[model samples]
Target: MCPTSPSASIFGINTVHRMSLQSALIGFLISRMLPTPLTPQQIIVVQTTAVATGTMPLAAGFVGILPALGLLSEERDGTPPIHLTWLSAVGWSCSVAFFGVFLSPPLRKQVIIEEQLAFPSGTATAQLISVLHKLPPPDTSIRSRRGYLHLDTEDDSAEPTGRSPSSPQPIDTETDADINEREFVQHEGWHALTYSFLASSIMTLIAYFFPILFSIPLFGNYLAKEWLWTFTPSLSYVGQGIIMGFPTAVSMNLGMLVGWAVLSPLSKSQGWAPGAVGDMTNGARGWILWTSLAIMCADSVVSLFPVVYEYFSDLYRAQILRRGDSSSKEDHEVETEDRLVPYTWVTAGLLISIFVGTILVWVVFGNEGIKPWATVLGFILGGMLSVLGVRALGETDLNPVSGLGKISQLFFAWIQPGNVVANIIAGGVAEAGAQQAGDLMQDLKTGHLCKASPRAQFLGQMIGSSVSILVTATAYSLYTRAYPIPGPSFPAPTAYVWLSLARLLRDGQLPEKSGVFMFAFAIVFGLVSASKTYAARRQSPIAKWIPSGVAFAIGFLNTPSFSLARLVGGIMDYVYRTRYARDGNDISLIVVASGFVLGEGVISVVSLVLRTFGVGVISCWGCGHGLCGGCPAV
Candidate 1:
């Protein structure tokens, strides 16, 4: 929300609704810092439910281009006057959410638990949760090592066994001494996380109060001195850098080097620049902004070629090759409380949501558009597209909902040409359905790792979705009335992109206004990126040096502050990897980083709320979001 650049990502909630859970996970750890630490399962239940609750807002809000399209639509008085109705928008969004819920179980079986696609982000979340909650084996030694941070574990799978030095009454068994030892480990873990939280919070507070430390353009005052680079220190981004591995760091920084250090300055000198390379506000909205978009949006579909083919081929083996006898050992093992939602409930929910959605659309639009056949088509497309969406989510952390939605819109527009409302509803279903399903599956993955019940997680998702219906509806009405989207205060750039596409499609051609070179370059780069990604999987030594298109796109458009903060985080993790931890992804580092993310995120949300209520936070003239003067004493 704070990003002033047009090239900024829309917070990526469609496929990975992670920030809230990330925060909640750390919040849970912080709670345990000075109090009784609940079991891992207990913390998981709270985190999943809390995270699940935030997903509806993703569908409701204009995070991606799909939800934001309505901002561009308007009702003009004329014969057969038509406009997108708020009721229809809310109703259809809810329907898509439910559709995701029902479709997720089967997808979970085929893709997640069975095929085991490397949903890296979800896998990382699961690993973090398991590590945080895992009680050390009873027979494990708890000797003081280098410092409180060092766990001194021989293995992640460390367990106690028969030992002559130990007594016959095994220490690994249920005993008072073992229980106390376990408590000590848990307490120490909490202590370390809390200290990290405090340290991160203090640093963040300093930046907010004194902008000299962060968020200022380097080498000059706002413009004309250096490339458009800000020294913004994002606590959450630092945490993100910790999670993504070293190859990712190098790839992303390489992009920043090329775009910022090279191309940006060159563009400005030639007078073909996007803006002042040093200005943080609109400097990033340069010609390269479009170039970055060409890479990101085009590569989203390009990368999906392999994933979509694999997805359908797997289905073919299950249905045609095996005659629909597709079952696995893990499914049977998970029957008790961790199995898929019942077939009847899922079926009923799907039917009801579809029916409700159609009725709501018809009622709101009054037969001006929105056909029943369109609704059915929407259901089919949404379900199919979800496979592509979740697969992209698993393999890469990128969400393809917006790209997939545009494709659906293109298809549906041809089917019912000139019916904007119908196309939007149809496209919205495809986009939102996949978006919700991807989100739920990520939650399910975390639960699976924590040994929590899948059935329980499904129920939690339903509860969260049901609540989101009311919450999202109210939020939409309130936020729109307050600031309005696509406006200066709430510039929904993604929505603008969607609407711009719609307009161009109506004219039956892409914009011919001199971007061919950029497009050609992007397409070629995207292809090369895709090829390199595939080749890298074969253990090619050269693969390590290949610049990831995804990382490059992020770094290419975003200010150096964004990349540098993440770089620092990566450097920090590498430091730990070399000296402190067995791997860069030590549980201790994750715990601390999680604390950093949660502490800052919580405070920012608070500041937003206070500002919303017309209460002055930290503000001053000539200040780029810095606390300038002393606050009025409370």
Candidate 2:
């Protein structure tokens, strides 16, 4: 999973309940009428659950699985039975759990304690949770039972700390001093979130009806028509860009500049792709995707070399040297035993999940399933990659799971030789493992900051991940049935990225010298990526100028219009921080961005429902129904 963007966490939960008056009203009435509203501790559990459920079957998992199963394209099967997909999802979920639970615990001392690497999103979330709990209850209501929602009773002094009178109470000096400040921020943040959500929701509905409102071609019509270089008038990308940061948004735009403005025209002129320039599959789009994937894979693998060495070196000392010395254990190595997830639990969980996953793989894929030895190899590689992923997440707040999958695919291509089924399964195992492990580690970082128990968090993670298996599988089945995925509305670009790698390894289908060029460029970019990381760690001034290979790869995958919207959003972030924000900690920006993403996302879901019912879509006229045709269904 990527960093816990606003869309991924708080806003997503808020909007779902807010979308229906019945749900919202019921929640409201319950808060007011019930004996007690949610406590701060309960609120933390809710947030933790949201984070937990967001992992396991990520969007990438869905994207990769669809193409891997050969269900997204015209030449492949339409869809499979939900039972089959659900069972497969079960296996996938278990594989992720194996790494998340069994593999993640050992590294807690190194990743979270010693190195103290800033998992930025996790840190942000921890801060947000702290601020939220600090907000005072309503001034006047039925009675303030305990938490934020309920009315204040006449005697406010009754159980002031929500504790029994006999219990010792610690003074909340921080809360008392910051009450006014917290109140101001709370009210403003709520207004921003609410107003932006309403505005975006209304605008989205309007855009769907008007159609022309979806497109806003700031540049000339010719460029918009020819190269998809237009402004997409939507808050989704803008919100994503704000959370993703300006540097990345700029990097993606640079990729668009190279891929669309430079490479597309170059490929067309040179007859490299040998098809219409605009064709997604056979033309410049397909051609550029390979290069993007190559660069990203290279960058990801190269960046992990140092971390991998350190991880293994630590293991060698603990396993080999420590055995001889017995007293060589470092101070940082010791953690509170009671706070830790028990080793017995980890061992048992791993054994059970691994057994289940292995059995399911053989059953699901039949003859094409990887052999038992190959399955073991996949797990080993997956565990190795999870370490790299956790390290990357610690440092940069990005998990290169897609690259991890491609790496596994490449390895399997050589091992299994032309077995795409084995290739996808192995790759999926590694990708899911890395993703789950990294996400869990990020959450652990949050848990550590919040002083939450690791054992409890792990249990919560297990339950949430288990539930996610069904939820994600059901969602994938429903969405596939509801709409023609890999089509305009659900492009599944990452799925194509996965498929492209599989085909390349399977069929050796590469344009003349393109593969050679891509590989060569990948190596150079990989070096540049490593150098950028080094410089950033050293606080070198030149680090900011060095483009992120991952971001550029994202740009290569996305259209120019999408990149343009992200660029606009990044600029907005810069502007807002410079002008309106206090020390760039203003809560309004986060709430607004969250609202933008949630509102648009909720509307998209609504549109998907409409599509399922065979409601016709309106065509945009402004930019020829989305940059000279290619408008997604509304």
Candidate 3:
């Protein structure tokens, strides 16, 4: 649900926080607007719908890249038809819905049940929902006596039967004292979240005018100016770092050190990339992106292979040996089956989505569209790759949809060589599939914890997806019409990266000097990631020291300034743990982080709207001078 708010929006608002923020906003609105408060089941439905709806719009971002780059036919107004854009969004929604319904179901048991991979975002959102609806309204007693209201009915069945390590364990019973304690905790949590949110929002607004406040040159002016090694005051990155954990942050900084300090300079000095240092087309940034992408790909492949092998092995046993469906199932299995999405529903949805999605692709893309067979192949590959995405999200709480999309691009390039439109569509389908599948799995995880019916959640997903078709389409069209994407106002950095990869695949323009480095680094990172996964599973101590490949690749992908800010966040987390943590739990830290992310994100959307209206911030402070980037004075 981390919809790209604006170019000015603060970074680091993660998926969990975004979803929670949206859910909170919607839930609050419903409570205030409705004549009566919703039941717990109704609340669950609302939250799930928000999540599903938010998850679907990512496809708009992916497809928006094409039109932004002038790949699509433009009307006389120099914009794609709004109707056509809406249709494209519908096509994307169909593709995403297919994977969410089809691919995710088959693997839920492996990822969420047997392995118990921590979909941390899901767990957090579920916790937030619980807190929000845990108690009745304060005025309920007064209103009930007047015969105007009834007490909120508690749904005892919603209690989780089992707890995953990532989620808080529910108490068996609540005494008066327990209830009081819970209320106190909730009060404190909400207080911290509210204050932190306001603080971050104020800081973001201030930084917009005094840009130097956003970027401090901590590593001396030479490094800051030359290599972009500056620290930032933005709480968003710090919050993100806190959420990702200290070790991962450290790993990311190490990657930044290697990429910016070592490889970038080395490549530039050797004339491998003679363009401007930061230029995405022919600069050090572009040069290193390949190696970074390779590392991510290698890590993804290495981490996924064992899981894929096991999945197929289990499938073989289940289908061939009849071992999957034991007559005497465990209690959990029995409970799960009662609420699980029925196979008949999945089969029907899958077939219909496949047909509709294929035709939509052909129609939307016009003459250079992907063939139906190729589109279906893309869906198959997307389904296969979604396992990789889902596993990543489950384990690390990061979904590398861009990396997944690039992999699809490479494959389509080989099969349907040199067709840029075909390549983008294929990659976009794959990206949407992976994204939607991962999102659905996470929602399912949340539902599992909440003990909400799977059927209800799935239905919520469909409704939300329908909503997404309209919302994403409108937003994409309006944004494209308003601003020049890939330009200063929007940048659309991820879209640029996607376009770059697509063109590279189309033209076969490998940076020769970086080829050996990419290959070698990919292998090394792959081994490191695979080894870490193996060691972690075996409870080996060495896993603690191993750098996360995904984080490392992210370091390479992002600027040094962002990495430094994250390092600051990691330090803050360590300090908090050492000084103030209770029972080794980071409940307060989570609250504060979520607040920071949500605050900046919400304000940034406001900023975007203001900027669009030509209502700009004034440079009233001396810090507005162009020492740091993005200064209004510049």
Ten-residue stretch with the least lDDT total in model 3: 139-148
Relative to the true structure, candidate 1 reaches a TM of 0.74
For candidate 1, give the lDDT.
0.57
**lDDT of each candidate versus the true structure:** 0.57, 0.61, 0.64
Stretches of model 2 off by over 4 angstroms after superposition: 1-41, 71-99, 114-116, 134-181, 215-226, 316-324, 328-339, 618-634
lDDT of 1 by residue, 1-634 (tens): 2321112223222213554346445645555655687666666666666666666655443443334444434442112323234565466456555777778778776555554455555555665554444533222222221111112245433222111123332323334443443354366557766776676667655544443454454555444134435565666667667655456666678767777776666566666654555332234335455556566666666777777776667667556745545353123234464355777887898888777766765665556656877877887888888888887776555566656777888888888777665666677666778877887777666666556677777777777777777665655554454343444223444554454455545655432221664577577777766776576445367765676666666666555666777777778877887887644344566667766665665554444444467655343323443212223211
Residue 446, model 3: Cα distance from true site in angstroms: 2.7
Question: How well does candidate 3 match the true structure, expressed as C-alpha RMSD?
Answer: 8.9
TM-score per candidate: 0.74, 0.81, 0.79
Error of 1 at 608 (Å): 2.6
Error of 1 at 88 (Å): 8.1
The clash numbers for all candidates, in the given order, read: 3, 4, 0
User: What tens digits encode model 2's per-residue C-alpha lDDT throughout 346-388?
Assistant: 7887777667766666666665456766776777788777778
